[model samples]
Target: MTMCPQCGSTFLQPLRCEAKGSDVLLVELRCSECQTWTKAPHTRADMKELDRQQAEFRATIVDGYERSVAESMEALATCFGHALELDLVTADDFRPRTASA
Candidate 1:
C-alpha cells in the first residue's frame, strides 16, 4: 500500500497508471484521506500487493460500519424496552390520523 507522506494514510487511489516499459509501471497516486499526491514506479507484483492491501482496507471499513449499525440497533431496542416499561408508548400512538386543515 502506498502511504501518504504527509498524513501516513495508506488509502491512496491511483490518479494515473502508465507503463514505464520493461516490467515497470509509473503510478500517480492520491491519498483519499489527506489528498496528498505522489508518483512512484512499481512492478506488476507490487501493483497486485497494493490492490490486496486496498481490498483489506475496504473490508475493515465495511466491518466497522456493520458493527456500528448492529450496536445502534441494540441500543435502540433497549431504549424502546425502557419506554415500554415506563408506559411511554400507547396504542393511540400507532393509530392513523385523518388529514385535517
Candidate 2:
C-alpha cells in the first residue's frame, strides 16, 4: 500500500494502466483526498511547458544545493569582510607578560 504523498493518506488505488513499451508498464495513480491523477511512466513530457516544469522538478536537489552553497558563501564572505574591516588579529597580540622566573 503506497501512501499518497500529496495527501499524506494511505488510501491510494490504481486507476488504470497504459502500455509504455513492450516491457515497460505505466500505471495511473489516483488520490482520494485531492482527487488528482498522476501518470507513472519511465518519463513523460505532455507539453513543452509541462516538460520544462517536470525537468525543473527533477532538478530540485541541485537547485537546493546550489542555493544553500551560495548562501553559505555569502555569509562567509560577509564575516571575513567584517573581520578584515575591524583589523581583528590572533591571540598572539594579547600574550600575558611572563615574569622572569
Best by TM-score: 1
Q: For residues 3-84, what per-residue lDDT tens digits would candidate 2 score against the true structure?
A: 4567766444467667777655476767767876777653333333334644675599689999999999999999888987
Q: 40 in model 1: Cα distance from truth in Å? A: 2.6
lDDT of 1 by residue, 2-93 (tens): 67888998888988899988889999889989888889898888888889998999999999999999999999999999999999999998
Q: Check candidate 2 and list the clashing pairs.
A: none
Candidate 2 Cα deviation (angstroms), residue 63: 1.1
TM-score of candidate 1 on Cα atoms, chains taken together: 0.79
What count of clashes does model 2 give?
0
Model 2, 5: alpha-carbon shift in Å? Answer: 7.8
Q: Which portions of model 2 show Cα errors greater than 4 Å? A: 1-23, 26-55, 90-101
lDDT of every model, 2 decimals: 0.89, 0.65
User: Count of backbone clashes for each model?
Assistant: 0, 0
Among all candidates shown, the one with the greatest lDDT: 1
